[model samples]
Target: MAIDVKPALSPHLVVDDAAAAIDFYVKAFGGVEIGRVPRPDGKLIHAAVEINGAIVMLNDDFPEMTDGKSTTPPALGGTPVTIHLTVTDVDDKFQQAVDAGATVVMPLDDQFWGDRYGMVRDPFGHQWSLGQPVREVSYEEIQQAMSQA
Candidate 1:
């Protein structure tokens, strides 16, 4: 059966370096390099990657696309949304991200939702949430949690 669904939440990051970001993503989250498009000047125009079963697309800083060229993440400070990836062992995954040049935004620990979770920001300034569901929570439990908060 053919399933029609979105593959990834593609986020465009205007980075000072694109190739380094690709390498970092690969080592951090086991991202698979799907494809890359290069411009005539031998610079990456676009690139795609599959990380933890989700597709993430990125490109170099292109002023033509955003009106003005910005080499940093954004003037607004950082990204509004954080990319979450569900893995088997979030602790190990979080460590892997750190080893791959990502900064640990949140230390690995248990959450109120009954999951071992953590967050990291890639070298290019993209934040990621790694988590592993440790136990299943019932609707009542979820309601209680919500009420407590």
Candidate 2:
């Protein structure tokens, strides 16, 4: 069965190995594997995982299927996008991801915007940011903090 809720916007990642990425996400972020469709050559054409009540879609990089366009991050020299995950506990989730083979891109700390936030890069070259709300900050407050920084 597919995921129950349809998200208006979901990030679709093209990875070198969809299976491995799925496994890593499950181990690191407590994601639930929704489903996967495999190609004839054993590469995944599509896969979905649910983490923190949201669905993330992924597939194996298939340049041939996309008119030789580079799809994977490494192939493109790196990705410019970072997926932000809002979790209940940023510190715990960040550590869990690190334990599961993710490399820390930033150390988790309470920010002026009132969140404990940090970033990590998955083995597939995808960057993910974990955040937990520590307190509610107004837009003006955030703007002031940004100006000061």
Candidate 3:
């Protein structure tokens, strides 16, 4: 019998400083610390945080995992993935993130697709797209809307 399976893969971000990253995540996105593991040397080996309902895993740079040195993708220039989140109030959440030190990448605005969407870069250097569904559009309506655009 073929079994169907779906595993939720939480994006893992390797930061040069996991402690600061955790604090930044909490402030910038209202993330809550779920757990953390520290090395005997006092370095954070791993940590998990909950943003809304999803879990995000983070850790201090472990060169062994990469090539001998690891750092934020931004420090290396660009990132490979962007984390997106759904919220009830995109505007207020976006502002709260900004007040907590996130850099606004896109101002919150209602889009043609019917979501109040915006983007921000957390102090930890991760990009996040915050969105709130404004209206539910049928597939046919969306197609028509896109065609008109």
Strongest candidate by lDDT: 2
Residue by residue across 1-149, what tens digits does model 1's lDDT show?
Answer: 99998654566665656777788889988989888888887568888888887678888887767667564555547877788899997888899999988888899998778889999888877788999999887878988999999
Candidates, ranked, TM-score: 2, 3, 1
What TM-scores do the predictions have? 0.85, 0.91, 0.85
Clash counts for all predictions: 0, 0, 0
Q: Give the better candidate number (1 or 2) by TM-score.
A: 2
- lDDT values, one for every candidate: 0.81, 0.93, 0.85
Error of 1 at 11 (Å): 4.1
Judging by lDDT, tell me the better candidate of 2 and 3.
2
**In model 2, where do residues sit more than 4 Å from their true spots?**
1-7
**Per-residue alpha-carbon lDDT of model 2 for 1-149, expressed as tens digits?**
88786547888999998999999999999999999999898999999999888889999998988898868888888889999999887888999999999999998999999999999999999999999998999999999999999
lDDT, residue 66, model 2: 89
Q: What is the alpha-carbon lDDT for the whole of candidate 3?
A: 0.85
After best superposition, candidate 2 residue 113: deviation in angstroms?
Answer: 0.5
Q: Quote model 1's TM-score.
A: 0.85
Worst 10 residues of 2 by lDDT: 1-10
